[model samples]
Structure formats: structure tokens, C-alpha cells
Target: MRKFLASIAVSLLITGCTFPGVHKIDIPQGNVVTQEMVDQLKPGMTRNQVRYIMGTPLVTDTFSPDRWDYIYSQQKGGEERTQKNLSLFFSDNSLQRISGDYRPGGAAQ
Candidate 1:
């Protein structure tokens, strides 16, 4: 009986103790970028102009010059389902190549 009581007291004490600290959390959800946005981009547009229209490209290919990659993905908590990704390439200050897991925004619709 005494041991059981001691255990209960210890449990209560542990539960009552609260550590003081601040924690910040980031929550992610499916933020899909529409294909229409990409279609609006035009050749001869400068880097700053492209960014102004399409925000910022997620990945910039370091191996090549005048090439940029844009990627977007979303996954719910924990599931092995495929995530969405988009890639775009630029050359001579214009969009040159685009390929990826997600659908590229087309010029029409």
C-alpha cells in the first residue's frame, strides 16, 4: 500500500512540473500554384520581372547559367502518397525549359 501511494505521489509531482520555454511551430498544407501563372510569363523578361510575376523560383540550377527551377510540394502529415513539384528553366533571359511532377501552367487555360 505504501509503495503504491509513493508511486502515485511521484507521478503527480512529475505531471505538475512544467518547463518554462517558448516554442514556435510551422504548419504546412497544400499550397498549389496555378499553371496560368506560369503561362503569363514571357520571353525577354528580366530576372526581377519574372520574380515579380511568379514570385521566386524555388530552385536555381547551379550547374548551368541562365537556368532556374521552380518547385512546389505538399503532403498531408504522414502518407507515402506522391507530392507535387514544378520545375522551370530559363535561358537567354527567357523561359527555355520546363519539366516536373506537377502540371505546367499552359498558355491557354
Candidate 2:
């Protein structure tokens, strides 16, 4: 009886010393624009056309209606964070230029 009780206590102590691993959920925020979407943009496309291709801009300034900013970010558990920003400049409601972290056709300018 004594040996059985001692064995049970030892088992309980070992189990108590062990810790269950924590689980973390992936967090994603803002517009998740892909490269393929940006590739579809053309210089003369209208605002509506740009919206159809890239969805609505994440950040739109009332003071700067000619500029649209698209941003994307994600953080996965125990992994490196990812982020991308794309800005479109317009003149007379037509897309004129693309800038920021991503550029179509591998162009840098």
C-alpha cells in the first residue's frame, strides 16, 4: 500500500512539472493585395477600375484625393512578420503613377 501511494505521488509530481504548450492564432490586418492585382493596374485606368482591381484603398486622405494608399500586414505565430505598401497617384481621376514597396513589371523609378 505504501509503495503504491509513493508511486502515485511521484507520477503526480512529474505530471505537474510538465507544461502544456501554448497555442497562438495568426493575426492579419488591412487590405491583403497580391502582386497579380497590382500587375493589372494601367496608367490610364479610372478610379473605379483601380478599385475593381485592388479593392478600396486602406488609407485615403480627404486632403489628397488624388493619392490612394494600399497597405497589407500579417503576423503568424513564431514566424517573421510581412508587410507591403502601394501608393497610386492620379490626375483628373485617372491613375497616373504607382509607387511604394511594390512596382509592376519589376520597374524601379
Candidate 3:
């Protein structure tokens, strides 16, 4: 009876013990683009030039060659931490329009 109790206790302890693989992944946080970066862009800038100012676009329209979309999104649980979307349209190898938080209102472009 004592041996059976000891075996049961050992089994219980082994079952209760956590093995491994339990972990918490940390999400990185930061801003994607700055207002200064967008202000530096000019109307005559080419596709490569715009790419140099901003990082690689998040969404490159497969169906459209003249539109470039840059989106920065961060979500934690059920709350949106940050969501910024920037769209740049190009025509004839020149920047046509810039729309987003990074675009400057009074800047000559």
C-alpha cells in the first residue's frame, strides 16, 4: 500500500511539473515613416528615388504600376496600437500625389 501511494505521489508530481516550450513572444514597436522623410520627396522623383526615401512598400499593387502603398500596422490583443497607411501615386516617372500623415501641407513638392 505504501509503495502504491509513493508511486501515485511520484506520478502526480511528474504530471504537475511543467516541461518546457512555454513562452511569451514580444512584439516590436516603433514608427514607420517621419514627416521629414516625406517632405524631402519632390514631384520629379522616380520610383527608385521614392523607394530610397521610404522603405520597401508594404503593398505594391499587382494590377497597377503607378500606385505604391505603404502601410504600418500594429495590433496587440483586441486593440490597434498603430495603423498608418501612406499612398503615393506616380505618373510618367514622377511623383503625382502623396497622401498620408507624413505628407507636408505647405511643402513645395
lDDT of 2 by residue, 1-109 (tens): 9999999999988876354665556889899888778888999999999999999999999999999999899989746889889999999989999998887865433
Per-candidate local distance difference test:
0.62, 0.88, 0.75
lDDT, residue 59, candidate 3 = 80
Give the lowest summed-lDDT range of ten residues in model 3: 22-31
For candidate 3, what is the TM-score? Answer: 0.61
Tens digit of lDDT per residue, candidate 3, span 1-109?
9999999999978866353543434353443776677878888789899999887787888899799887776665434467777889999989889887567544555
Better of 1 and 3 by TM-score: 3
Candidate 1 lDDT at 29 equals 38
> Which predicted model would earn the best lDDT?
2
Flag clash pairs in model 2: none
Best model number under TM-score: 2
What TM-score would every model get versus the actual structure?
Answer: 0.52, 0.75, 0.61
lDDT of 1 at 107: 40
Clashing pairs in 3: none
Please give, for residues 35-82, the per-residue lDDT of candidate 1 as tens digits.
677666665677778778667766666777566665555443343444
Following a full C-alpha superposition, what root-mean-square deviation does model 3 have from the true structure?
7.2
